[model samples]
Target chain A: MNDHSTPILASQGTPCLLVDEERMERNIARLRDRLRAAEVAFRPHLKTAKSWEVSRLLMTTPQGPATVSTLREAEELAAHGVKDITYAVGISPDKLTRVQKLRAGGIALTILLDSVEQALAVAKASDPKDPIPVLIELDCDGHRSGVKPQDATLLAAIAQALAPRARLEGVLTHAGESYEARGSEALSAAAEQERAAAVMAAETLRAKGWPCPVVSVGSTPTAFSAQSYAGVTEVRAGVFVFFDLVQAGIGICTQDDIALSVLTTVIGHQREKGWTIVDAGWTALSCDRGTATQNVDQGYGLVCDLEGRPITNLIVTIVNQEHGIVAARQGTPRSDQEFPIGTRLRILPSHACATATQHDRYHVIGAGQSDVTAVWPRFTGW
Target chain B: MNDHSTPILASQGTPCLLVDEERMERNIARLRDRLRAAEVAFRPHLKTAKSWEVSRLLMTTPQGPATVSTLREAEELAAHGVKDITYAVGISPDKLTRVQKLRAGGIALTILLDSVEQALAVAKASDPKDPIPVLIELDCDGHRSGVKPQDATLLAAIAQALAPRARLEGVLTHAGESYEARGSEALSAAAEQERAAAVMAAETLRAKGWPCPVVSVGSTPTAFSAQSYAGVTEVRAGVFVFFDLVQAGIGICTQDDIALSVLTTVIGHQREKGWTIVDAGWTALSCDRGTATQNVDQGYGLVCDLEGRPITNLIVTIVNQEHGIVAARQGTPRSDQEFPIGTRLRILPSHACATATQHDRYHVIGAGQSDVTAVWPRFTGW
Candidate 1:
């Protein structure tokens, strides 16, 4: 970042993707070791850390398993020689072809579907050569997907209908709402609630004589705080790979633990409007509109310097598709002084998963944030 | 979309890119004919229309000309036989390797650089065998890149510095701020302002004895407007190919003209919270903060039916990386009567480019909305 002769490509360009490689390596090691100590299989969600370079670290571990929200990630990760992947999104009758194509190519693929209708559709359409193995989703957080744990009859119906043709591998749940917690204290409690609910559904399925191997409970907040695994066999969490402002706001992870950021340049100052325009717009930093009532209302994200510290109360308050408005952190934006145009800065994403998808590569930054060690290119596609 | 069992390999998933083949064809035809009538070269910006399929259409217009924002696009377009490309993004010294690689790969590439330091960097790093040509970017609206027109002395100095080792081709300016205008009237004024600024810059550069060939002024909103194209040689607007909510919000395009939207599902509901959860989250819709202001706060996007019609004012209100919250359009979300889970809905993207990055394919919905036509796939890479 010093007398690098030209603008540090790392310090220049707007709409840039920055990864704290050191922090990422630590997160990877922690997750791998924690699961090993607990004697449970670990599958890091590739959706958060989209970079194959970061994801490659997992292959060195025992259960180099991974999870994805789209078929694109499956194809990309598969090409990278990291095979074990679970397409975590609910399966529709249509995506079965993409799923089949992945499985046919020799990638161990697992999918999730909740309703009996969807399961039946997938089972009916699945090829005879490679039938689909599905994890019946269970709703623990009351946030999304999965039937209620109390609806044992409905759960049995879905499993029964899907079991004949499709393999009912396990039950999966995500306490996504755990991200709404105020602190580790609340997050720990949310974790317990997530575990208990998922376990209850697993027990209900067990009582009905179903083979639910993967009693999954996932969410960055819950995954970090859950003291008990109980009936869970596998977990499916995504955001832990690159904790964001939202996660830190909820106390799931500290600001120091956050790893991903959007690199931007100070473009111009609208002194009249009191707005600081940066090159990183909604296009570079994603539009994860998660300004919870409690969390810091970072317009889009917190603007930080190269050392990774917030620049005053400055937060990107408004953003167009390719334009962002940075304002004073304390009050309204004051475009009084001019930072040299093209000054490099980083904007931490509100949600890691959303921001990671926008960029195809990551200029991995490391070496105590002073000097970048290497530029590792990652893949994103189906 | 239909009961067609062919697995059209598309027509499913939220945050999906829909190709308004008709509107696109029209937009393309109109731009070509209008530019021809104006007697100005039309070097369409590929940044807005990133599809090779779309680029090919522009190249086929006999102009055989185009502009690119990323080296990846230039390489891809070159592979597709598109030799003439202007790399619009301001390059840092580090990108010298990429520029060299592209030049050797046989791409007729011209890049943009503003200062003498960059010109010197390029001259020093570039292979003597493949000296680069540069477009001295001009600041038209004081939006993003380029030297100020009034600073003719500085422009001449940089141009002369790069002239020995590099060909100073022309001046290009993107009236990106045109999108900030509300209607055609505002766009017209912005267009005139942009044209006047570009002309003045060219006049100043010419007076300094620099033969700038490409005098350009463009933004999709002003592409069709702006009567005075004096001294302007070409247009470099991009977003006209794939219109979105931002365009519609600016009254440049109608909602019916929007070609892309994500098809989602009503996953669950929080009755007490007055919200309905949709499968389309920020990952699909993109966290593109907003445009102009937070006024059109389509959290993730506007939820519409499969056929494409807004559902109440119930903006996607809030979104997580992969989860969207839909509420009552008129008032608060009233999930009193349980919305039978597993309902399919479409959420129009706030910006087509950002949202399209999250997906792998475009499910071309037929005119009837739900009828499946053909599937168009896109490739993303550096």
Candidate 2:
């Protein structure tokens, strides 16, 4: 193994995910500090930076709980000593055995349930002596799954079904529609709606004498935009640890704040089209046009220099499975001379979660240095 | 270890890739038979199904060569006894060392070079006694990389730069623009252009007495649409093993020919919005919206039943990192009851290359059986 103190990039291969350690730390600190200031417990979602190294730095509370999208992530984190984890996606009956295994391993695992059928499935699958803990999913923005917060009848039925073998923990809401927000005002509105919906669901459950202890609400946009987290016990958000072009486009964070980028090398060029072909294609950068609906359409991703400075007027125009076409934004002269074969560059992703999933590990560049200081493996698949 | 003859999917978890053995074999046979009829050597590109099992079945010539996008793939295939492998991507100076290592391992590795700079870099890196074999990449259609085939001066200059340290082996071109072809007429036109351009480049090289021994031309659409391969020696195409929605939309293959799909389970639903939430999201299915530009806009992917039959009017409308929203197409009535919680479904991807990269292994379903007979691992990364 290479020395951790050595510059990591110097010994690394191209077309690898590069996490700026300082920027990532700063991004984590900003969110943690903000949530702390709001006096709400923060559960950093592990769905974005699926790395133990990054998760270690993200922990504000020692051995604290977190949110995960898949059981695989929960199992990995649990093996690494993370105690509490909420499998954020709605529960499927088939996964009950795996969840039981995770719980048996001493993980304080909580599952998400929105329907009575799911609650019954979990209750039936659970051991009566060791009841499974679950949070009721509330639909805040109707962007995806979940029961509406106002559907008290359905919520009560689900709670009743989980009585002996499962425990009704609280309610969770994700303002995924907040991603469609065009401005701060819209984002703030969506945040408030998300907060209100989760708080309302918790209140309705408590009014009915149900123990709704934890009211969770958040999304990366709402986590930063919410004016208050009043009745919520914990806020959950991912992607802020590595701000992407989508977040930057919506003014969630500046382009400079993006901590994750793909380190690539210029391999060839198409002179007539004024395109500089790079090794980081859709396979490396990902085919996430997250910013396409935003104010500025970052075709594939924003082009940056080796040091992560934005190359003005340059963007990845098109991409194949293994080839990225970098060219001027519009009406700008080509700079083929500036980016000859073997020239290294960094590409800020349109969506951090999408782009990061394409790679197996990250070549972490420490603050104020081009060398890779560390390498962190990330797990993928369900 | 699990028995290879056992039903693989019966014990496997959800949200995993499922490859239909029969369809895949038939697809492979069709391509090989067509190429054989055309009298051109078939060299399948391993960028799609990066599984050694698939490559084994793809070999028309015993222990024959294939094309790869990355050196890592070349190395892996070489280890598995694929002798004459071609690293299809344009060469970078840094990769020359790895190429040399592969060559030393008795693999007749051919690298791609489109510039004089790359030629000189290879020549400088190679040992005088064992020159590196290279193919000059020609720009047939201004879709991506390569030097224009008509530019004989630049080609001659590159050949001169190689000298004794590097050998100019042949010429190759991929009509990636064939992806834009909407109908048979357009596809046939693109194929002709692809064939004509590649042959012209080979003829140009041979006219200059450069001993151009090989001429390769292909793309999935062109491979099937081309009327003749006249002067081409070999044809290369990936994505044929697992046809996808994009290929179907381009009229290359019917949806029935698609062999790869994601096995998912319905976790929850939004009744009012007519949406059924699935466990497979962008992470499992990939974020490739390849069919978005085609005549049919398959949102994330086309939703199919457990038997891999298309569920009429049902499509994955949106996707989160680990959740997919399955809904009815426009003008179709909602059918949430038809797809309840825990109901297993198959999702046909928009692009096989993009989708296959998301999974670590394939759950191989045998011919005419829903049960999986084998599990094959696929490798990824540059």
Candidate 3:
């Protein structure tokens, strides 16, 4: 009744996060099927989609193998019956207590460590209790973290220092540079780099008398590119659930794979200047300038109609706390490209993780208005 | 013992949101002091802090004036005994049901409208119900919404047509462009523009025989700059409760006025590259590219030590979902800059409102760490 009679448009709303439940299920099912075809164990990171509801949907088994950033996530998922968890952060000194508590909870906690200092902290903490099993993080192509795979002596030193007190489980590496890849070839090359790094680190740990059972390597882009897990024990990825503009830009997924989006209402229009303001600002769609530095900077996010097609040369130029100015990307502002007042639009998030943090709940929609499956509430507490 | 002996840090752990209760008290006192000095009615916007506890502090009386962005905020504040409320959004047809319900609940509700079509919609909706008082949002700057002051006749016509079914309350405006102010002069200019536009609009409305009562003009930056509210009846400002880096960058408030910050721990260090990665990423601090184009672009936010002094030439660059990399802004990499594992650091928010939406609760810290008052939860459903 409010002017937007489009068959695909939902009722006008602002500051709302929408999860196309059908698309989300398809995205998850596709990835799980792919990992099944590759015969690789998929331990999806809970950090991307923090919802237990989404996590429950993605998993096929009762004891879901998961990847986590904080002890909070591990504890939350662990409490929800998600066992076989990998706390995929370099364990800090202060968090030892929480880590110990998590370990004592009969949760299979696998903490990642890079240096001897952290190894000492975890080793001593585990000795008084039980062996805190840990995976030695190896530096891949991206020089973010990890003991360099070639630095096998340092790995042996760390393993020697902690092996008696803590269990040296395996080696893991993330092909983060694959996010920077433009196509499948670059993603494949990045995957190769990741595999080689983890394999080399595991071999070094094994030769040096450290048990390296798990060799984990995965990124969404690389999961498909190099599926032959030669030395890899498991593949971990989180973004495969809700593909973003970044994932689509990397050619890892299509636009249809982007299951989540921000549902916004067009507030007003500056017809002369060729800009329309929406109620969903950075508070709804996060200010992640993801893929902004890429060849084509998807400013803020990709603007789509209810049907979800990219409106090229259109950019969310400016954003206040609760207002986004959707304007022409660069040149002359066209007057014809105007959505009247109170029009509903959906914006594709640059990164699913950043955008998901903005809203507290997601409205799971089937196809149109009559197909609203349910309203799933997601918890966001640090 | 933790490597870093910062006992004052978060026990649940580092890299979370901290709310200084004392600072919050002082901030509220300052706003009250400012209102007393200016002799103007103050309506604190709940969109800034979004905390019921903070709202209770602001409410000197049960019938305190407040502005909210969502229906949830209005209903919550109403339940908390706040009577005079302004639903500060371009009202949509779908939310009119809630508005009617709110009006029926005996809470004084004022809505914002711009164009004639919207005015007509509101007029038609309030048929069985009494005419609702409406505030015409005046466009002081070409920032977001509202009609310009010069277009007063069109505004008068719209007011006249809707006056039969809706009460034209008065003129109201927000100088959102004040955030872009370089100094006090620019801020004052923006404030003057805001005041003048609303005053002119009020004059135009009054000249046409409308009994306009409230002439409201506000915005955090403008409220800081403008004085002598000759025609203005009330001022609304949020974000002053927790001043952020954007507020500091504009030369409005000092770093000390900032009451909220993200508590982050040094998780990993690339010592060779001189980069220290923190656990708080775009998810914690918000991804606002705040005022970056204007002279000084804060990459994510200003990185500060525990005491809140800027780490000169160091900025957080390339943020993923839950990872923020701190690197030297200018000089070559230095070894001393690389923090050891588990070093706790406070991160300044670019925009307090945007940053606040990331967290569910604020860990209220008192005079010091030993006096941890309590955790204040916020409402985030819409």
**DockQ, model 2, C-alpha based:** 0.79
TM-score of chain B of 3: 0.94
* Per-residue alpha-carbon lDDT of candidate 2 for residues A135-189, written as tens digits (9 for 90 to 100): 9999999888788999999889999999878998999999999988878899999
Residues A1-382, model 1: lDDT tens digits: 3343234544444467888878877776776677667776667777777667777765444235888877777887888776678877777565677788888888889988778777788778776567787887777777766677778887898888886778778777788777677766888888888888878877888888886777777877787787877777776666777788887777767778888888776644545455666667666776665654554676688888766777767888876555678877545545355554456778888778767777777877765675555666655543
Error of 1 at B25 (Å): 1.0
Candidate 2 CA-lDDT value = 0.88
Better model by DockQ, 1 or 3?
A: 3
Worst 10 residues of 2 chain B by lDDT: B1-10
- Span of ten consecutive residues with least summed lDDT in model 3 chain A: A1-10
Ranking by DockQ: 2, 3, 1
Best by TM-score: 2
lDDT of 1 by residue, B200-280 (tens): 877888888888877877888888787768888888767767777777777777777777777776655555567777677
Worst 10 residues of 1 chain B by lDDT: B1-10
Q: Write the per-residue lDDT of candidate 3 for residues A189-227, one digit (tens) a residue.
A: 888889989998899888877779999988888886884
The top-ranked prediction according to lDDT is 2
Docking class of 3: medium
The positional error of residue A218 in candidate 2, measured at the CA in angstroms, is 1.1
Error of 1 at A149 (Å): 3.3
Give per-model TM-scores.
0.79, 0.97, 0.94
